[model samples]
Target: MSLPYFHHTPETASNFAQNLRENSVEYVRFELPDLAGLSRGKTVPMNHVESYTLNGLNLYGGAVTLDSASIPIQGTGYNEDINFADCLMVPDPDTVSNVPWLANTARVICDTKWYDGRPQPAAPRTVLKNILSLAAQMGYGVKMGHEYEFYVVDAATRKPLYTGQPIFVTSLLHQHPALDKLMRVLNLSGVDMITANGEYGPSQWELNFAAMDGIAAADRAFVFKNTVKEFLHTEGLLATFMTKPYKGLAGSCSHFHISLYELASGRNVFLDAADKDGMSPIMKQFTAGILEHAAAAQAIWNPTPNCYRRIRPHTFAPSNVSWGVEDRSASVRIKASKDKRQHLEVRVPSALSNPYLTAAATIAAGLLGMQHESVLAPERSGLKEADDSFKKLPTEMHESLAALEADTDFIHMLGSEFVHVFQTVKTAEILRLREDIPAAETNEYFDLY
Candidate 1:
């Protein structure tokens, strides 16, 4: 297949416009990833797309910084502080693609910027790009692969399509026709899906795509999610990436695999031939960096209150800051430890994490480790929960946010403005949810109190 025609320059934009016309494309959706990893933008008619692609689309300034519920939170500086201004959404031409399900509709991911052309500091995508830029300057390029688990249910009833634990069950994988269709659509949309399976939960499923460069991987993840949700919605089904959708069932996770390659030699920096463990010095230091900031980074990895429910024992989710060679229970699992394909799979992020923010946090933490030349700690074995020696992860959203705020270095690395806005928005979410008393709380305490 030919490479995607980027709409970066006027010549390319013209070519894209001509191609759209030749292909009879009617509408183009300009999408920006918001704080919740949700797509926020406007769809333009084909006639107006070229101009918008060359320039930008004006959107609400708070679009990318809005709360999880997409509400404008005060003090974010993106909203009330700026009197609710407008921002520009410039299409990253490299992200242009056809919207498989929509008739003659195309989609292009965008970067958020101020009306006057300044970068949108709090935009999740922008934060990630800045991190990647720093890594590039440090003489390395990152490769990231995202593995997402989601549950499929009836749209109106909101219940699973099946009723049994079916992890890797072949017949169960085909139980829902939508899964196959979704997979095909994703691949057609350039996701390059490599695997699909039924997960631990009754109707939960995971589909993985091939790894790509840092920005591309995150872009694919963002597209994969929005595409799955949007496509499933049209079929009268709901595909939710919520961390713990069911009370007793397994929680969904968006485990990300990361590796660094020397830009000069294009060699995986994590591999070592002489070392007994095959972990290069750079890899060990990077792992140490991830371990050091695990708590603080959890604010982005598992952003929502519901995310904490997934970090319990025996859930294949890490409850502590731990790392081990090929240990799934550890927060950072080393894969292909003795091979050229060595990489780290960070299991902390919930399915609901913003892809951009997650990538940024992971890269920033590793950069810190490299800067300090930190040594990797002793590895944990077996179920990490059984090991008390490991440091505990924050069990709540507020706690994670507090950890993030306290990590001055991490805060500085990921931009203080972005962190401040993130904290403000998330804290607002926490406080808003606090007012609501759930049935579980009422049932457990009302009569006793």
Candidate 2:
């Protein structure tokens, strides 16, 4: 019933089993975040959980590279190449949490490994872990925060809970009991939520939680999305993190915040009082790296064809690869606090992005910056989208994927295996999208042709 922070071992698993008995737990959901960041795993009865926790459970290896439709793609080197292999889902005991809304149910996050005991390199969570390891070797520890915007709607009707563009409206914030219930459950489940409010779009809401170190932060984000959707579904409502569900409305986004700390001294490494802009040289280089690979990174950030629609002008989404201090208009905004609190806010990721991949790609790019001592361009003043000085980002999923394929340096840093699997899965999605014709397209071309 309490938040657990321990490694998975025989002793720890035994202790966890004892805790489950104490809490009268009936089932444990051994969940894995799949390629599209969907929660996919097995549910085990409490009687079998201890053994599974210690020994791990079997899962389809192809799950790690499944498309948005949950179909495993071929030629990804995970499915057919391995003859549809099974991967081990080894539960990380530290990620155990009580399912506050589901009585007698608990959840534990897991990492995937091949049957032969090798970590699944193409797994999003594994990719993130490797990137964090690289950062640690460079004497830096990463702190991360996520700001997520999503829409709540009636599951049957698919209509917004309310109809208004009321950002930060007090009455609107409390308009739904679902919001209050969600906040309460998340806090009870150890999300450490800080704020929940009505966003710019009707039925849209933004909730934020406390930051944590690298892998832990990404785990929290993955848990947050799954919890919201599951709990809301039980309440006869649907919570969607889709990039854009309605036209002429604000799209959902998950903005990521990151800053590095000196591992040896345990001090914030991005702050520099002597610098004119109050940013340390490391921070600038990190920003430079992010900008340099923004286009390629977009393949991960905006994975789906629909996700690119959220990046248009005046949508509060970035259209160009640019950074500015406190500039929401820029792709990467430097929240300059002139103190330890200073960090980079990457606003490019859509809500549908896998948190693990986002963190991995961001960290990988920044590390390249630090490694090469990359220089940042001058900060721009006006709206980056309007500024001809700034270069435009990839406008479509295909373009982004191509950019990702071309960026050998970035791909090398992120691990070619992971990148290859990601590209294959996303490319499959694009091929499927190309065959589908929307009603708008039919309306515009059917009669004319």
RMSD of each: 2.6, 2.6
Q: Write the per-residue lDDT of candidate 2 for residues 215-301, one digit (tens) a residue.
A: 889989998999999899988999999998899899999999999999899788999989766799999999999999999999989
Displacement of the residue 21 alpha carbon in candidate 1, Å: 2.3
Backbone clashes under 3 angstroms, per model:
0, 0
Task: Give model 1's TM-score versus the native structure.
Answer: 0.96
Query: Per-residue lDDT for 251 in model 1?
Result: 96
Q: Which residue runs of candidate 1 sit more than 4 Å off their true CA positions?
A: 1-9, 445-449
Which residue runs does candidate 2 get wrong by more than 4 Å? 1-9, 447-449
For candidate 1, the C-alpha RMSD (Å) to the true structure equals: 2.6
| Lowest summed lDDT window (length 10), candidate 2 | 1-10
- Model 2 pairs in collision: none
**Can you give the TM-score per candidate against the true fold?**
0.96, 0.96
- Give per-residue CA lDDT, model 1, range 36-77, as digits (tens): 989999999999887887777899989998887778999988
